[model samples]
Target: MKRGFLEACVLAAISGEESYGYQIVKDVPASMGLTESTLYPLLKRLEKAGCITARSAEHNGRLRRYYRITDDGRARIEEFLAEWPSVREIYTYVEGAHHDAR
Candidate 1:
């Protein structure tokens, strides 16, 4: 179980490029689960911390807020990337152990 922190998931979401809130929430669960309450504050905090920036655009007559990773966010992602191997190793070991037990 490589459950990541909100910042990690949010960072992962924007690693490739920018994304809207709904897209981030929607895409995350496919690989890592995230709920509205969990993601929203993280976004706000990141915005305040200068790790991300937000912009609004009209989509289907509805204004959607999009979050883009800034230089600071990219730097944070690099830090996370450096730490990820250990996290991944734990999950892989757990999964392997479970399979071996069967």
Candidate 2:
């Protein structure tokens, strides 16, 4: 459940344009707790899923991998946006109930 949301965030970050791994992690919210260890695996998973494409280019005489959003990735973003309202409502309800409990 939460993994889908994480995937959506990664997709959105790369959606702007192809970006390197480090830069992609930077674009994500700090609250996500995304670190290189976490983000690298997630990027590999996304690439394996065909949601995005990774290509290597030489910059400063070193190979750098850049991620680009695919058509499927864009569609995924749309799906996430559509479900966001319901997710928001759930969060609101849970927070209210939890606060009352506290």
Query: Which residue pairs in model 1 clash with each other?
Result: none
**Residue by residue across 1-102, what tens digits does model 2's lDDT show?**
767877888899988889988897798887787788888898899888888999999999999999999998899899999999999999999999999999
Q: Give RMSD (Å) of candidate 2 vs. truth.
A: 1.3
Point out where model 1 deviates above 4 Å: 1-4, 85-102
Which pairs clash (backbone N, Cα, C closer than 3 Å) in model 2?
Answer: none
- What's the distance in Å from true for residue 4, model 2? 2.6
TM-score of candidate 2 on Cα atoms, chains taken together? 0.90
Best by lDDT: 2
TM-score of each: 0.73, 0.90
The global C-alpha lDDT for each of the candidates, from Candidate 1 onward, is 0.82, 0.88
- Strongest candidate by TM-score: 2
The C-alpha RMSD of each candidate to the native structure, in angstroms, is 3.2, 1.3
